[model samples]
Target: MMISSWRRRRAARRAGKEPRRNENGEMELTIPRDFRCPISLDLMKDPVTLSTGITYDRESIEKWIEAGNFTCPLTNQVLRSLEPIPNHTIRKRIQDWCVENRSFGIERIPTPRVPVSSTEVLEILSKIDVAFKKEDGEGCRELVVKVKSLAKESERNKRCIVTNGAGSVLSEAFQAFSKASFDVNVAVLEEILSALTIMFPLDGEAKGFLGSVSAMHCLKWFLSSGDLSRRRNAVLVLKELGQEKMDELSEMEGAIEALFKLIKDPICPTATKASLTVIYYMITSTSTNEQLIAEFVNLGIVSLLLETLVDSERGLCEKALGVLDGICNSEEGRQMACNNALSMPVLVKKILRVSNLATELSLSILWKLCKNEKSEDGGVLVEALQVGAFQKLLLLLQLGCVDKTKEKVSELLKLLNLHRNKVECVDPMDFKDLKRSF
Candidate 1:
């Protein structure tokens, strides 16, 4: 019987099947009952690196010591720790394997979502609206958080609430709040502007229109707020609004003052542009010209307008010329404007370098000065004429599709003819030929 059993065992060993033990009297592979590590709840940190000279963190080492399984996860052999393996290295290897296998169709865990009901959406919108209407700042803040949450969940709904409810609601609320108290209104205005900026590119039609209306309302409110800082901010906002609204705003008293103030302020370029718009409106509106021109002089605004001709902004320089047109239409106003402008040589050079529109404006202004019976330096026109300004005017007349340009040139020609010997007269035909070509 013993011989038979020995023969069977030898036969099993010879069949290429292991006796499940190595020379060291240890199992070749020992699978742990639990695959998770106590500390990390992940696969064993640094598998005991027996031959690899790798080490692991204390928790991993302790786990291997307790499990009595010091084999590497990869090699599945008895580990020999030659040196400690860094936790980072172990993590890197695991992460790299995860990435590599992921491309091969590994199962991925999905991120959890927070569910929001339709009622919650409506309620949040309502709350935001109410907060905005009542000027309840704290309520508005709370609603903003809820709105942000909704936005994160659904961009469509996020845009709806922020744009329609939050954006417009906040703007109106701030306007009302500003009306109640200047300081509070200013604060609310600042906050509302900030909210609008944040909610830009609002999604739907309702939101888009609301944003436009809100922006316009904010601009109007700032202009009407009567606060200097608010007016300054209004100037900036109106500038951003572009020429369309600016043209509409020119009719308002607050807008007029705000624009004039901007022109007068040494620091803001916006004033130069705004002043030009105001001046344009004032000149074109025949009824408002006298009053507007008087206001310009009263406010000491003429000097600044003249000064802007030298400003780097070409648009502003042209606008200044337009303002000069209005100023020079009246006798006292005309003299005042010419004296103010010609006093600044740099301004004169700027005007000379300007476009044909600007040159025509300068010519009209010079013509006014030449015709002024009260001009302190009536000789300025003669001096201007000496520089061939009259010839330039006549040249401009050749290009005369502009009725105003032609009329001004005709009047200037008449003045030169009337003052023949006093001023050197140039033939109108010379300019007429130049005009044909120009």
Candidate 2:
């Protein structure tokens, strides 16, 4: 408590423009306006000034640009140059102030690393080429580490690395590793993949070059064998490189397996989301392919969707349900849905739990399951009755639903009651218009 209080007083002194008193009644020094970034209102680390004549921390301004903002954040003026030149003079001054205030207990910050230039990234790429040509994995690993460090430093550095030919160079290394039968040391492969993950925003051309059967082999190695961090990075980079190659994922080994594991037991939400996105694309693209649908069911992808629906947030649940809806169009998929005990209850529960998209998708899955085969024995409808799905569907109708949704609900209600007595709770008076619709 005492140390925190002392630090609080020191912080107040750092920013105390009017020299306010602390809890102990000690007056603090006032910070000058010049020491602060105009946007963040804090001490600038690697301050860079825009063409609009306002200085900001490099990160703040870079993010603003990356988010698609074309104007200056503070001035709102159209920026003549999105590129911000470094304000080295101000950084030096802040360093000097910190040194002079040693008695005030404010620590001095070290010089910030300079952001990389495209020319320098190109030079590194050239070195990577020479090292790889000579089969110098050690030299290649060193240069990769260097490139990853630069990319991690800032958005500017990332753009520099990708725009210049470094992204392709990294992909080529992975391709070579795959051709070598994964003989490269695990550490070397990791460094190569880590560098590729950092050098992101691979354009269409770059993605096209990297999207190959060999590249899929490299990604599969990482997904199946690499450590957790490398696995996540592999997924992220795969998400980028897979943009133009979504269809081929179904044929790729470890693609569905790794993605299913991530969705079922996620290392992180980001990986799960990436996995879902890739799966969603693959499923939507190949819903009619018997082999792929069989693959999904065989890999427990449908059961995983049920589990995902139980806890996923609105957007992710919507996606999971969308994939579920698509695959349920296949006979094997519907059989899998009926096989999993939770699939029925969970699919019914998703109605009105998340969103309108979720509701429609859930209804579609149920509709697929009820057609001729599964509903013939009245098993799925009985499962619905046990899970209170009967009540939920009527409540959905009572609360009023869209025409198509109401149509499906009425049809399912008829099917549910077909083999048994009229469900006592769902009053005919409540569904007068529903009666007319059927």
Candidate 3:
């Protein structure tokens, strides 16, 4: 009886001690230890029983596997598959755990609320348009801030709102800003311009809307205003809208005329750059008919552009090359471009150096010159050939072969070869001598 009593006491002691199980299966789990889930890096949410009869949070196990930390907590063996953990089972376990763990009161997280709806966004944009029309600087600012806030919530809706609203807002802003002679007015207008620039690039629809309306208004404002600083600012803004918008700029009766006048005004280099940029955009974006080319020729814009090209400013030269390319695209355009002595030398030099826009433009100009053989002046084609322009053309063809410009380069090469042959045939000895001189 004493030995039996001693055995019972020993069994009680063993039960009180922490148990560890081996292959023999003689152990007991008392207090469950907290397990970390690899996915959330938090305490395990859903305790699951695996096929191996091991219990774990399915999410935690899957996360561990996903993170490449696939070792089981108890066995220290890599998990073969996490796919066996049913999502619904894991969710139910998590729900039960959350319900039982009342130690921490459930705190609801407040989701961020989107303050603006589609209709509200449109309404706000309409207000901005009205504010701009009335020259209400304070109102415009308020609406702009509101619109921006709404845009942050729903980008697509905000873009739609702005696209429809740009024209009215731009026109009003220009009118109001132009009429104000005060510094305060200038400050307000600057803000409006700044706001427009920010809002216009939301997406394609927004850009198209601004392009069709705000661009024209901007051009008009610059033309009507004598304030050099304001004109300069307007030009800067127009240039920033990019070359694509230039095609959309409506050629109202006075727009191009005003630009020409600004170009003639030598006092403002800033305005000149702006005007050149505008002309460059026009040339690149639109088709130049005979009448329009004639108008540009008569205005002496070509000579002005040539002068700008020779100026120390690299940007101006780039713009002029773009313009020259436009002019040389047609038969009449080629004659107009080549008629001036200053035009040829500068164009030749630009071609030789491979200036920014020069290669494509030079190829274009050469093509036109070759097409209309009578249009070829004394030394224009020969000078181009002598200056190693053909070699440059060849190089462009080789490089552009891998890019979208390949087809253009190929056509240009064909045109250059034709012109090279003409020059060779006309004065073979002269061409050879010129080549040697170079």
Model 2 residue 116 distance off true place after TM-score fit, in angstroms? 2.2
Clashes of each: 9, 0, 1
- Highest lDDT against the true fold, candidate: 2
Write candidate 1's Cα lDDT for 57-80 as tens digits.
Answer: 345554455566666643566656
- lDDT, ranked from best to worst: 2, 3, 1
TM-score of each: 0.49, 0.74, 0.47
lDDT digits (tens) for residues 19-138 of candidate 2:
666789896555567887777777777888999988888888888888999999988999998778988898898888777766667678779888887679889999988877677788
**Clash pairs (backbone) in predicted model 1:** 49-80, 50-79, 50-80, 55-84, 55-85, 178-185, 262-271, 398-435, 399-435
Our tally of clashes for model 2 stands at 0
Top TM-score prediction, candidate number: 2
lDDT of 3 by residue, 294-328 (tens): 66767777777777677536665666666767666
Winner by lDDT between candidate 3 and candidate 2: 2
Which of the predicted structures, 1 or 2, would earn the higher lDDT when compared with the native?
Answer: 2
Instruction: Give the C-alpha miss distance for residue 403 in model 2, angstroms.
Output: 6.0
Local accuracy by lDDT, each model: 0.54, 0.76, 0.56
lDDT pick, better of 1 and 3: 3
